[model samples]
Target chain A: MAEIIGGYFTSHVPAIGGAIQRGDQQTPYWKPFFDGFPRVHEWLAKTQPDVAVVFSNDHGLNFFLDKMPTFAVGAAAEYQNEDEGWGLPLYKPFKGHPELSWHVIEQLVADEFDPVTCQEMLVDHAISIPMELAYPSVAEWPVRLVPIGINTVQHPLPSAKRCLALGRSVHKALASWPGAERVVVIGTGGLSHQLDGERAGFMNPEYDRFCLDHLASDPDALTRQSIHEMVRLAGTQGVEVLNWIAARGALGPAAREIHRNYHLPISNTAAATVLLEPACGVWALRRRSPRP
Target chain B: MPTPPRPGARPEPIPGTTLFDGDAARKGYHLNAMCYSFNRKENREAFLADEEAYCRRFHLTAEQRRAVAKRDVLGMIAAGGNIYYLAKLAGIFGLNVQDVGAMQTGRTVEAFRQFLLDQAKGA
Candidate 1:
């Protein structure tokens, strides 16, 4: 059976892509944000996951209002990134694992989640920026990917509870698959920041901190709020935390926070990165004990 | 203007936030579709070559056309533009999020950047 290794939750702000492209990670403005990733890199180097299941939202790249799926999964053998109209450099294509993707899709349907399955998908910065932050300067990503997109663009989005349930379904699918690959689940986007209307610059760091504190230990607590309530508290765009909540659902009930970094005002968004491992896992245990 | 609330049915406003609901979606479809076309380089170029022609191609409403002409972010939103799609339109003029944020909030770009930095102090 496939081993579920851990999970990562991070903000996928598009400006991070431009900053990385310009090699501005060390600039004072970007340093605090970029500084959050070294620990993530260290963990990735140590664990070396063979496959990653990413839960992210499409910001008008693949799906527009014409046809938006509440939840979609990529079953392609490869995924490509393209221009998002902001002149960010395009990233190299990410390799995909179709077999696991099909298996998960099959399991999700069996579990009644009913996600749209895409064989050809164009990923935008939401997935690419986080991949860059995770594996900086890589020609090819180290792990095969399964890009699961949730609808954040269109209204009447999947509720926080529904997204969490969707993640739980994904967790069950991965656990039942008979593959040997080590898998890492990722949820990308948000801590809080809005980018529309009069509240374009809204940032609720207190609420963000409350979410980070509870996501690993009490994910269900985070899910109790309705979508409207979430939007009110987290901001319109800040509700991308749905991705984080879904990703946390994949970790099951025994996950522990191994690492976390939160910073503010990364391109009109609150930025965050959190790493989790099974509570009984070696890394989680190591985190609790004093360094040698 | 927003429709008046029904008697005893007032929903609290989010204060400067507009939820891109079905009403907004229907109202801004052509405008958003026009902006969405900006994702492609050629479409962006075509729009740049003849802005009025491009707006006509999408059949944008008079209000939407005026909003785009004036680079009025708030007016665009009032005309039912979603920020995600509006961003592509903003990019054509080299306007980043901060620039748009400032425009919508009636602040200078530097002031908007400073406002964002001030968030850190609150955090």
Candidate 2:
């Protein structure tokens, strides 16, 4: 059976990608945000998971209002990043894991999550930034990408409970796959920052920190939160916290927090990074040397 | 089949705001698509070179085109503009999302900044 190794959660702020493009990672404004990823790099180098199931919301890249899929999974062999109309540099193609992606999609539907499966999807900064931060590769992405886009753009989005249920379904699917592959699931975007309305430039370090703390030990509380509650307290766009809830659900209740980092006011958003390892005995090998 | 909402049901509107739901998305389709085009540098240049022609090419409504021409952030929002895409239109005027937010709230940029500061401090 396939093994679910662990999960990671991080912010997908485009400006962090901009910082890397400008070689501004060392600058004072960016140093803290950039510093959060080295341990992620170290972990990736050590585990070298075969596939990464990335959970991120689109910002009008692939699905516009024409036919938005509240939950969509990408099953393409490659995903190209497009310019988000703000001059953010597009990176190289992210190699995809179509077979695994299709399997997960089939299982998710069977498990009643009902995601729209896309054969072609042009991912934006929400998909690219976290990959760049964790892998920082110009050649090819370190792991095969499985892009799962959840709707944070439109309202009446999947509730936190629904997001968590989707993640749990994904976890179940990964555990049952008839393969020896290792996988790491990632949820990207948000730690309480809004980009529109009078509340623009909103950053709630307290809310963000509270989220991180609970994500480590009590994700259910966060999962119980409604989109309105999240927006009311965390700001409108801060509703992207649903991504983190999904990732937490995949990690399961017994996962241990491997590492976490939070930084405020990074490009009009509060940025964060969290790594969790499943406590299942199947993952014991991850702590030892890499298998040949 | 899914359970239907009770007859005559309507969601309570978030005060002083447009929700940008599927209905709003349908209304703003052409408008947001036009704004999405501004992601490319040449597209931004084209729109800047001839705003009317650009809106025409994108088939924006009179309301959307007017909103674009006048740089009315709130009006744009009311016309179904998603804030993310609207940021591109705002960018053409050297305005950040915060600046657009100020316009939406009918507050000066300085006041908007102070409002954000107060919110952050309180949390």
Q: Write the per-residue lDDT of candidate 1 for residues B6-106, one digit (tens) a residue.
A: 54332576888888877788999989999888889999999999999999999999999999999999998888898999999999999999999999888
TM-score of 1: 0.94
Highest DockQ against the true fold, candidate: 1
Question: What shift in Å separates residue A43 of candidate 1 from its native position after superposition?
Answer: 0.5
Candidate 2 docking classification = acceptable
Candidate 1 per-residue lDDT over residues A1-292, each given as its tens digit: 6777889889998888888878999999999888999999999999899899999999888999999899999999999998887666688898999999999899889988889999999988888888889999887899999999999877888888898888988888887787889999999999798998878889999999989999888888998887778889999999999999999888766688989888898989999889998676464355436547
Clash count, one per candidate: 1, 1
- Give one digit per residue, the lDDT tens place, for model 2 in B20-117: 67678888889999988887899999998988898999999989988888888777877888998898787787887657767877788888767655
Docking class of 1: medium
| Candidate 2 TM-score to native | 0.88
Off by over 4 Å in 2: A280-292, B1-17, B39-42, B98-123
Question: Which candidate gets the maximum lDDT versus the true structure?
Answer: 1
Model 1 clashing residue pairs (backbone): A198-B16
* Model 2 agreement with the true structure over A1-292: per-residue lDDT tens digits: 6666778889887767768888999998788888888999999888888888888899877776778788999999999988777765677788898988888898898987788999999988887888888888557877788888899888778888899889888877776677888888899999887766544666778778788887756777786666766776677788888888887777655578899887766766777898998764444444334547
Residues forming the 10-long window of minimal summed lDDT in candidate 2 chain A:
A280-289
